[model samples]
Target chain A: MSLPNPSFAPIDWERATPATLLERIAEAKIVGMGGAGFPTAEKISLTRKHPPNIVIANGMETDPDVNADRVLLEQHLNEVLTGLRIVARILSAVHSYVVTSHKKTIQVAQGCLNDNETVRYLKPTFQNGAERELIQILTGHVVKDNRFPAFDGYLVLNVHTLFAVAEAIAGKPLTKRLVTVHDETRWIDIATPVESILESSDPIRVGCYATGHRPRVNEVLTATVNAISTDKSVHALPCIHCGWCDEACPRDVPVESLFVMAEQLKPNLDAQDALNRCNDCGACVVACPSNIHLLDHVRALRQRNDIEWERISRATQARLRVDAREQRMRSDVIRSDTKRTERMQQQHKWQ
Target chain B: MAVTDRPKFQTTGIMVHVVIALLPGLGVGAWFLGHKVFLVVLVSILAAVATEAIGTRSVQTLRDGTAVVTGMLIGLCLPPSVAIWVPFVASVSAIALGKLVFGGLGKNLFNPAMVGYALVLIAFPMQLVYLDGLTGATALDVLKHQETESLQQLINHPAFGLVGAKHFEWMNLAFLVGGLYLVLLRIVPWLLPLSVLLGIAVPALVFLPLYDATYSFGSPWFHLFAGGTMLTAFFIATDPVTSPSAKLPQIIYGFFVGSVAFFIRCFGTWADGFVFAILLANAFLPLLEPKKVALDN
Candidate 1:
């Protein structure tokens, strides 16, 4: 289906059914461009049943250092556009938006758009690209208190993700990604596979927290890789809640509250309202005054609690369904017996 | 056996409770400072931990939460405009000079956070004031520099007798709220802030009639609010290492801090007095050791 002025840069396009979107994602091996190495196809397959109405291209490179999106827009605008169009088409989105900061980048992207009617630009704010926060601002729709962008009819993608989507349509697999390595002193450019990038470079001396893992040539670049070490030993101490993290959080989630809630013996839903909405951005870890491993703890608690709670809920629901089925069968059996008894009595009277 | 066994208090649990008790003040600080504050805090704390690890030449991660506490206190003391590197520097100083030099955490006599703050203060006094202040109004600037003099002349300045006194008063109120939270939570015993307040106040009261009676005892409150007074009360003076462990010694330590703080505020060339007083008190901490109880009596 032709979308009204779809924003894809004019390279190529592929029409994918929900099934095709998943199949192509896996075949292309497209990975999450927002630093996570998760296979894009896996994410697409999981969320395909629930189509997103609004699509966001997250450009808020709040890292203060990394500027790949800015660079991509500056140079590869058309290529990125073609990918965005494909996503919008597949998702059946009403509106597609680009979230970015660099003025020059937005200008360049806009210029390349050739006045595509469906796409608009969102000025970059701190944490502006966080999927949930971006969705809230763009669509004014918040997902279920504990849910994510998928719940709000919004699908948020990074500039890199769009680039990957375009490549996938072109039948190119995701084999490499752009990694910005810089510190108080130097910036280096290297193109290595997702697993090899960490192994190729030395750990940076500063801003390790932002990097998420320590720079070591031997370490594997995991899904949640940061330039710094995330080991408990290297992780900063617990939060003293100086409000720095909450204030610094560009997404404006209560990171400290999430930490406190995770520590509570009995999880109080009201108390943990903050964690339920957390976007898992490492910004809070950066802001914590006590250098609390805030994101780590919050994410761990969220994952653990989410899994346990979901299991219990599913089990309960299954049990109820089984019991209801049994009761209905018993009622049916009694009714059948009553009919048989009447039939036998009528036969005897006739005789 | 006679029922003469004394109950064993859970010291570890008590310490944890003390750390836990600090959360409310922390929450209030976070509420005001926002997420950026957390970033500064985390960086400073990580920097502090790294510094201690590197300084001691050990791979061991410092636990006791002392370095973290120090980094946080320093972060709170610092103005938001402070470069990220400044916190890194302060954290290092707090852990290295303030804590590790004497030993780690509880063994140190001087508050590590103040040491870090003092280091930054020395290195970047200009940066310590928020960007808003350089562009707008800061409480101390109004009081010390006569920023509100034009308005004062118009109203006769009766409320505060000074042009910016009213504004400074509110800033002081914010600090007081921060300070009270610390005290109420028992993060730092009241003796430190109370004694420091008294130390500064009693002298101001005694000298007010002789020096400048118009400013009077209220000048002490102004002094408390003007610069880092409240911050120091909640953060610095309460440094576990720098202050005596014994209650009476802590009171005496606070008294000295008050007196010296008053002296610096009254006679020193600078407007702020916490650092000089803290450093002076740190020197006296050894003399007030618990083992020296016989000498004191």
Candidate 2:
């Protein structure tokens, strides 16, 4: 698949002033477009107050059937390099990395870099794709629960997200999304327009398919299309203590306890010990075959615990008021009954 | 207009919707079974409502009007020529034993109507299932007895024999229309009905091609129309508390039920497979949860 006119262009990589970088990102509204859809400009601006010494481009498409980031790395290597360089320059980071798992994609991206200074490739395993896990692989520090990589001057962005950031620096808004349509039944591979993908055919559905509204092709299919992922909000079944999800997680994280604790009352959930310990990595949610949105459940549990604590405190106050009112009513009833009996006795005596 | 914020498990609404939905079936039943079905249905509804009212008042609670609906459904499920007292006992058992003893209403584990039918089934199997010559034996009953009669011979019943089988056909239509209404109203998810319908249809269609000298597939249409399938797909099996909470799982649950009901009717212990299949699905629904994925942030 070679193009006749393949004159490649080089991207300018320089440490721009914070104001210039902010202007570039805001002009494009390129918040983190790839992963969570956070505004890229805003994230970059936040880095101005707290400078980062390292920038990592996330080219790992670890989601089982998703390949948006990997696709961009293979075909748009030069553009990706330029975007990674711009991101590094904006943050004024000394060490920059382009992380990926696909050997071909990494090789192509390396070819585009052409032995450029300050650009290196870090091969990622399944565990290394995680933001914190990648940080651990790069610099021997495993980010425990509650701690963020920004604290250690490390910021990771998906390759597509970085490309979007570069486009944002060039003043473009997000009007399109990359969708991977993998047909489980037919084995068809596609990277079609979002609308076309939505309208195409029925694929394997998961997640939100159970409880949320059924999605039509008319809707924007953001992620990959397969039985592995659903377009609807997921409904959780009551955990039957199989402990399979915990055992399956590669990170050795106990997703089942988190799910159980989220649904039922646990001693340590409310204490700082539990609340501050989440690493924000999605192993539990991924490892679960029940399609239980575990991290979402944990967040719900945290909110519920706060409400429960408040409710208990309010109930205690309410009980005291109820006791006083009941006592007053009992006394009044006794007084009235005595008067009624006396009147009845006097009337009967006369008769 | 905004969509009504109906409760997820609107047990009363479900019951009411079903009764209102059953009007066509009730009318057809009355027309074929004579005025007896009408009387039985009315009495069943009245007895059910009255019993529920008494139960509520005794407990000092406001009635939700669901018991009457259950009674009417039970009446709909029974033979028209049944004694008047039969429905009273059935309704009582449905509410008292099937429901209230289990903590009432949404707390019941089995379909209330099926529970009532089960009581009648065990206690008065003869009176409950037998109907002079007008009603004849049910299709499944014939299958269960393994009469070894040809399809042509089986269709010759005075009530159900092919030529004048209008009652059987009409009864199935009425139930189907009511079931469709429930689906259109979105009271029940489309998957359950569709899957069950397929569950019954797929095997029946296959067996129709393979139907031979020893075993008959019966009428596939008869299988869908006869017995409690319409009631089960739209009402009993759709019990939100007992059924799978999710749509995909619900569909799987429904398909398994329909398939089992068909199997039981064709090859297993009974002609009617609704109660047995539903109970079986209830036991295995926990194992069908869709696998969830963790997002790598």
Candidate 3:
């Protein structure tokens, strides 16, 4: 496929400082575009202190149904490469890689890569697209227990996100993105209502079916939406306890039990842990024969945990406030007693 | 809405496949046992669906297809000559008491079919016996009754078929084919059914050699193909709701079910102990599923 002509002018890298570029990115309000929606400027600022050793342009669209990243790389290879160079230069990275599982995207990206940039092919798996998993695969170094890649000097940005960065730098102001709507990848502008794009009468999903959220009818498109689907509704059946969800979980979460707990609305501490570990990749949902929406259950459990945590924290704060008042009253009583004793002693001395 | 979110299969679809897989066994039973089997199946299904609808106060529950499955299973377990009302009562009780009272479908602790069969087995034992006016001592019953007969003599008995039991072996083979279809379709896990078969066969193998002139308990093939063994292994005992969900637990549960049924057949009063054996294994499901209690909490 012929590469799309770069709509935005090339960044004047020699004249522009990292701070000015970051400010312009912030002004453009460019987010991660990798479904996380984290602001690009904040991510770049976080890695500024660490001085990144490597920058990875993540094009591993592991969801079998999502092709936004692959299409973006195939159509706008130079723009994505230019974005990667700009980010790498800002981070002062020595090495840079464009990671993808798509053969066509890899071939086209390889042809576009400069001397410093290399194309890394990773076999498409559900978890391999995750920030931490991609970093671990590219660099044998683990991100080290609950820490993010940006904190560890590894700047892993999604290919679509970099394309957005390139656009933002060229003064496009992050208005449009390549979204896969019903398996067909196309450019969709932000703030375009979901109703306009979907022709189907089915309920709208904001992302790929596996990990997508059901959006309100009037909700507008956002930068992070990589895919949209008007899939038919699945009539959920009772779980047959097949343990397929457990087998499909990338994080070894007890998905079956978690589903049970979520259904019963009695999530425990372990269920909370499972919910935390769930990356919302929807692998369990895909593997389920009964068509149980397992990811929805996990999200519900997380929401419940949040509410429970908030309640406990509020109670804790109230108790702390009451304890402080009681301590103050006790101190006042001691002070009054001391004053009374001192006045009596003075009166006795005067006598 | 996008098409990628759609599930590839539905629960109703799985039930439809299960019904399709069961056709071979149903066909064999109708051929050997007569048209009355179909009548029994129809009555049982109607009664089950009606009971579930009444109990849940929702006609929509019928669409899930579980009631039909439960009814069909109870019907399959009954003798061909059983009174038509027997299936109706058994199916109603299976849905109402065995399933609905315990919270319907996935929540039921015991296999509904086994519960229904066990209830009728206790309530109307006389009606269950004497299929077509022949003393309904299934081949296992005949083998159990043999005191001084050698293995060769037992094999030669009129109750014995070419390899296993007369008429019953073919029925078992039919059920085996149906069961295998379910396994290959991934509707039912292979581990549970295989373990259940192994559960019965291994004990019979170990004890078959001990069967000399005076104490012939039948061979592994006889036990495997004998009355209700294949049916219970595939249809009744392997019920996903009652059986253990995980692999290791499923294996142990299957073994427990098989061994118990074999022991009951040998020493107990029942001709085929599969019903009671499956119910017993169902009771142990909580122990096997250690996460169940934690998940409930």
Candidate 4:
């Protein structure tokens, strides 16, 4: 299960201080490779403020179609572990864990684990891939209800992000990443034009098919891109009202009603709550018998909600400005009237 | 990395499955009622498709196959002895007035088949007479007309079969099989059919024992197996467009339809009241569906 050659030259651990490591990560501009794209340096710094108790390397690829993390774990086990140790050292974390469900991935990771490091296996599911959910699984603490894992003295980094961190420490800028395109996992350079990878005229999805966006043709691969795919058009049909989407949703979000609301463009407040709760995991789409692109509807509804929010905010700002101006003008007029009356009174007393 | 949509099931596939499940019932209906049932079904289907295509000005909707389903359902509800033109008119009305007028397909509030059936029932009552006048009474008609006869005597009547009304019981059995297949496929929700049966059976069970020689009512088995009970409960009443989609609402809606239909059959004047019962439930769908209620508030 281990990689054939773990001959990666060891990082100069004795010479590299936490400050220097943080500086290098910030300079490389490495962000979360888990697709959130939050800067790794900032996340480390935030966790360092509280001196995290644990650092978890998230290798759980819950998206059934995406295998970039699994492949990275298999191919670059040493580099991923080095990155995990580096983060642990910088955050002054007491214990570090590599979280994965894949047996081979865990075995490879276990061969390279240090004294403070442990391998934790979690059964892969869509919810387990989420940072909050992963923290809950590993620590038995629900961070999602109130605060983030980092706020609770835990730092969770994606395995791919740790790989990028290792490369950044080895003096490579954040550039190339493993991306699964057309079911083949390969190292794709960042900023590679999507058109170069897309071989067909099919719609280009910028991530896994389930949660990926239909990227414009001119878009380029980025540090966060885990998978790219050409759209295989599902022969979609009208909804049969089967309610499988409702059953499949992890958050119990009432996806069937959300679909109807999204289609009709008449989403209510309850639908808004469903939209917020949706993680866009695409499980509902997978469960749908009609092949409805349910995530697309969810995204569309969210975008519409965002636009509506923006409009209301803009209108409120404009009204506030007008009211402030009107008050100022009224004050100015009253001052002028008082001065005129005082001057007339003075003239009358002199006469 | 194969970027196909997650779920591979197509809406057309569901419709195709539903149509396949219905074949057994159609076959039974044809055997008992003769080839005219097929003719009526064919005419209704063609008329419905034509109305949808011409009214909506879109031929692509035919691929979805809902029009075909609506047409077939309307045709099945018709009396085998009904004039061919009656189904044609009903099919056209079912698609145009019942469906298209409500903005077509998923937008419609009423079950198109039930709407068309109710329209034709009111307009052509005399022409809707069944079985070539051989029995002169359907099971519901017999139950409604019963006076000074015991339940046993009613069962021994010429219109009555061992299980239910003559020839109708076999058709009902075929439909029950088809409906179960639909439920197994998960195309139709099980709650609707189960609740509908309970809705009818519970009431009939409580009422049948009260039957005296002066007021004869059919047994629960006879009611369940009788004319249009299985067909309406499984096929017509469970139409997604008209029926409530959420679990609790769907159960309540099914129960309401079944109970009202039974009440109409036992005490009301209609020979079979499924059409009216379904229509009445359809009217309550917005109130029953949790989503619609949330939206209104």
Candidate 5:
């Protein structure tokens, strides 16, 4: 499909405040198309609060099977670059980057970069594609646990989102996206029923086959849905503890231990580290020799962890309540004893 | 982290590679040991496959090819001189007891082949010995029995060749070459076999100077190439399902297996103590596993 030519309007960069730009982006309804469908406007707003922010146009498709990003970059390089600069202008950032793993995408982006902009190719791996890992790789700054990359002045947005941002500036709505149907790429409308995309009842995952999930009943295409894979089987063998999952984990989670914990459907304090570190990238799933869905196990353990945490919190609250009551009673008894001693002293003096 | 680097292998594919790698060593063994070695190996393979089929009651389970590999390993571990029934019994136990009892394949704690071999060796110690009409004492036997012979004189014995046992050294060399192929293909990690060798060598070297040359416990070279040392290092102890998988744990496990095996060969009556050492190491696997390795980077 051809690129949309919506109603065009010239940009007035001088008048574009960060708030106005965020509003436009919010109106566009853009999100992180390459990864989790987080609201792009809120992400930009978060990064904007931290000045001297660095904007990264994420042109790299981390999924090994999906090359939709490369095609998007090749087809709509202008709009993507414009969208990146719009974010940079919105943040008044120090610099901007256009990072992709594809050689062709790098070449396409490199020519249009300004003096403040840089484009480079990073070797494609699951870890490098992740947000925190990508930030660490590019900037050598580790995003701490429970912290967002925005705290470090890093704004990462997918190229598709940028395309929408530019279109939003030109007065257009985000109605269609590039969906990888089987092997071919097509412009699929937002909220299109997943069943209509592929007629086969054969099992299908809603994302990249390597790391995606089965579509929920009547699930439709959203910004996060990148690929439709139809060849997966629901059946999986028992985990052999081969340690391939451990080797394949980008987050350095001890997946084998987690798998053991998951097998019992109970959360163990022993595997708490693994449960915290795992982001469910599905790298372990791809690496498993037994065709086991290791992510499902990790997810199961995480749910158990949540329940365990709830019980622990309740117990801790009960313990604190008892401790507080004991302290109060002790203080009250001491105060009463001091009053009684004062009364005795008064009586002795009178005698 | 790059899943795309190596491609096109599953349980079936890996077992097939293992079987292919065993060919050179199996060929060398039959060439030196006798035609009966092939008979023994074939009987073991048949028994293991049949047992696996019966245990699971599904032909699809046989497609995994683990039963064949288990049979081959049991056959190789046994002496060719044993009766045909011995091979059958070992193969059955290797599949049914060693593997199937513990839920088969990856679930078993001990090396399947060693479980069967160790059981039969304990039960029928006399039957497990190698006794050709040409020479009764194997290389390890010569080391233990020749009290009057000095180290120099022992080298000239008919059982001894160059730096190792006459027929066994060739088989060991064949197994070593095949093992290197597995390592090169990245089918098996190199740390496992290398650490195992280092484990045995360090102890052998340390004890060499302590003992009198007249009553030497064989040189490090002889220890490496003698008995089932090479086979154990490469094939048996390196089994991923049974052995420790993490780097630090694997090194410790390999070293422990090697040192114990060496100590048993030198002090105990058994000609080769690898089976016991491996099972013992397998027992300690959980303790050796690294608790957690947080990514520093």
Candidate 6:
């Protein structure tokens, strides 16, 4: 119920060295809690080679309908900003930003920003939280789809990661976070049994209804998970082919076609290519008038495609092995012929 | 628990609304045709529900209310003077042969209502027509038989109204109101219905000059208001399950149905062209949205 102040002391920025701060961040074992769960230490470690880098605290909270970031920013605004400053110091960031979709979070962030730091709000849309999308929105610079923003002198950290960084600087590891369980928002301990979060016979989504997956058996709460939605699952009705899912899709994926393929349980190469464009934003799930859980079908299609990928790769490898062996045998036959001709010539000379 | 983001209606909800919209049209059809219209509609609904219940043997499938809509559409498409056995046959064929045989509801290739109507229309053409039986007797039939009348004399005929067929004009207005309600709810795509109306009207206007004043094929307004033109445009042709989903595809599909219906009404043997027009359009569906392995974009 209480904010985890634990006798909080403001960081002495003048005395904090970049190497030591990075070590403290590493010691905390903090991670991006905005669904990806990427290790913060490893992420920041890569951005060191490129200077004049920008640091952004991603309070955007792209996990559809999840309130973890909003609540965290509301209660722990100082800590989140402190974590951002701590990351900024490590790389001597030229500029720092606190980006969020929540109106109140942006207002709170703006009130406490330093000279080099700025805060802005984005009109929340599906995939607005993705790295490339965020980069495109804020900087007006389109990053190549194949490349990562971190490699291009950008450091985007989830607000929860920043909060953990602040706590890490205060000599605490990331052990707990604000999680939305059903409708309740509170600090949940990492590794708590997921079943304990909500008591529903229906399948539970580990994040929000839009983007969360059904937890595996005995799955526990992790830093990446910000919500545990239960009692939301329902039987999918037949696809009326209304194209609502396609309209809702931020990536413009042909979700109805993909869903049809998924239902047939057939592997399709075209579906595989289309899946690459889909970020699994769950917009389609929200848009379906038939209450079809399109994300489930999308995931099913993904699994099918993955299996198809393995089969294709394995066949290619087998063909390559056979071709190499044939080439080696031909080369060996040529070598033996040359040796025989040399031996015959030597015998003729002796005669 | 579902985050109904944009006022989403489930399949059952959509079907319920469709049934609601059909009521006004049903009432008007019954008022114009006679008490037999009520009996025919009731028989069709009961038969369709019974067939569906027996076919699937599931109460849950019955709850979706699609059978009811199909029954209503088929009932409205038929003449009120048809024999009692006719509605039963149409309903049975609609549910069994038209819908369930193709794997039920959403998987149906053609509009179930049109399939049943077309079947009965072809099988017992005399029963469907009953031309001389009733005084009002459908405007299209009256228009077909009146070849010697001049344009001015045709307008004075009891079968001809200001713009449309005599009794059918009011019936068309009722159906239009119901359709507009559906469009307001956004259940039926507006573009599809609009395109169909334009499809029929544009050609009728173009062919207005070619009319021999002495020969009667009726005016463009008569064609628009008579028979099942509005019904097919708004309700039958716009059936989302049988129709294309995208805007462009819907436009093309609607236009094809409308133009074909116009041609058939003008030249074919049938009094109304919608039943065959819609079925022909259904056969062309795969071309509009080909089920290719890859749907680029």
Best by TM-score: 6
- Predicted complex 6: DockQ: 0.40
Look at candidate 6 and give me any clashing residue pairs. Answer: none
| Model 3, docking class | acceptable
Return whichever of 3 and 4 wins on lDDT. Answer: 4
- The CAPRI class of candidate 4 is acceptable
Model 5: per-residue lDDT, tens digit, A1-351? 546544334346446776777787886678888768899999998988887799888876767567788778889999898898889988988988888887887776677779999987887777766777777777788888788989889988888889888887766677888887777888889889987887776788887776777779999888778788774435455455567778777778988877766777667766777688777777877777667777777887888888998999999999999999999999999999999999999999999
Q: Which parts of model 3 have CA positions greater than 4 angstroms off?
A: A1-10, A14-20, A114-116, A120-123, A231-234, A331-351, B1-8, B53-59, B133-136, B209-213, B290-297
Q: Tens digit of lDDT per residue, candidate 4, span B1-297?
A: 222223345677777877887889999999988888899999999999999999978898788888899899988989889988999999999998898897776777788988888899999999887858556678778888884389888888888898888889999999999999988877788899999998898999999889876887678888899989999888988887778767788889989988998899988978888889999998888788755422433
Q: How would you encode candidate 3's per-residue C-alpha lDDT over A148-231 as one tens digit per residue?
A: 777888888989888878877875656678988887999998889976887777777778777878888578998888888864
TM-score for chain B of each model, two decimals: 0.73, 0.82, 0.94, 0.94, 0.94, 0.93
Candidate 4 residue spans exceeding 4 A from truth: A1-10, A13-15, A101-124, A144-146, A171-174, A232-243, A254-272, A328-351, B1-8, B56-58, B132-136, B161-163, B290-297
Cα lDDT tens digits for candidate 6, B217-287? 66778778988878888899888778887889888988888889888887888888888888998998888
Candidate 2 structure quality by residue, lDDT tens digits, B6-79: 22322344557767888888898788778888877787777776666676565322244567667878888788
Across A6-119, the per-residue lDDT of candidate 6 in tens digits comes to: 444444655878877777677667778777778888899888777778888887765555778888989999988888888898888899888887787777667777899988
Off by over 4 Å in 1: A1-31, A35-54, A63-65, A89-94, A117-126, A139-153, A182-196, A199-241, A250-254, A257-272, A303-351, B1-297
lDDT for each residue of candidate 5 in B17-67, tens digit (9 for 90 to 100): 888889999999988988888998899999999999999888777877888
TM-score of 1: 0.46
lDDT of 1 by residue, A1-351 (tens): 234333322333453454555456566556666765666665554444576466677766655345556666666667677777777777666677876766776666665553332344555444565666677777787776566556546677777778777876766554444444332212122232233333333323212344343344544433222232223324344333234455556555765555555665334345345665565555655444344667656766676677767887999999999999999999999999999999999999999
Candidate 6 stretches with Cα past 4 Å from truth are A1-14, A61-65, A115-117, A231-233, B1-6, B130-135, B148-152, B292-297
- For DockQ, the strongest prediction is 6
Q: Please rank every candidate by DockQ, starting with the best.
A: 6, 3, 4, 5, 1, 2
In Å, residue B165's CA in model 4 sits off its true spot by 3.7
Worst 10 residues of 1 chain B by lDDT: B1-10
